[model samples]
Target: MNNGYFGFCGTPTRANSQNLAEKLSCLHLDAFARKRAEKFGLDIVTTSWEDNARSKNSCWGPCITDMSLGVKEDKPHPRDFLMSMIRKPNYRDETCDTPIEKFCVTVGNEKKNSSLKRITLKEFLQDIALYTDNNVKPMWRDRDSQIVTSVQA
Candidate 1:
């Protein structure tokens, strides 16, 4: 799993570049999948972004280590911290801004799964997202919450 910064889509600024940035910013995950999709010339099926409100140094650090690590000086792996934050979105679900806390991953037997773990705020940031029906893929399956698809016009 990958982690970093995140945000929600606003409105399109330019034609595609600005619009793409807004859509990308709205996702609860980093630009990993988006970047990968662009790299492989694959059609974008999801709108995700990097959660920048969490940490600067590393997402999996000071917070977890602060409690779990015996030594106060030892640093934890940044990836671990990033994973934690990427699991949850930092927003309310009452309005268009629904919180996204799960990530999309390929599981064995051709299954996709999203894992929810505990992460420290000092370790990871969160992505703010706007509500939309543009999502056609399931964020995670065989999990607790039922995944829904929403598209944006």
Candidate 2:
């Protein structure tokens, strides 16, 4: 196809993925996907971990590439987004920020025969969250845990 790069999401969980093991996994897998895509003429874009605060160049590389490759006019460029960021104060999330509205969410799993369900975000949270004194909190969070990365061909 075009002279573009291939991408893979959900690594580091984006480390622009979530941790060290994930970051490395993303980098290596990005390399592998790139190679595979070359054979079929495809370009995939993924957010990867950079040395600077694990961010710095995260979007810069992909943004430039996207613009150069003729992204749709409706999509905002990174530079335009930055300009909007400076003037973005009116938007608000009533569900998460104010709790005034309960947004509907789709919940499901990858298991076969499992049916998806649409429920209020608050209701979904009640299943996985703990409530005390009217305050809602998550059941648990990752805390400096180590993870292993491996690949097989």
Per-residue lDDT tens digits of candidate 1, residues 7-108?
Answer: 333443455343333344343254564454435443233322233233543444332211111112223322211111122121210112223344242223
Each candidate: RMSD to true structure?
A: 19.1, 18.8
Q: lDDT by residue for model 2 over 82-119, one digit each (tens)?
A: 10011101111011122312455666653457788777
Off-target runs (Cα >4 Å) in candidate 2 are 1-101, 129-153
Top lDDT model: 2
Q: What is the lDDT of residue 133 in candidate 2?
A: 35
lDDT of each: 0.30, 0.34
Q: After TM-score superposition, what is the CA distance of residue 143 in candidate 2 from its true location, in Å? A: 24
Measured against the true structure, the TM-scores of the candidates, in listed sequence, are 0.13, 0.23
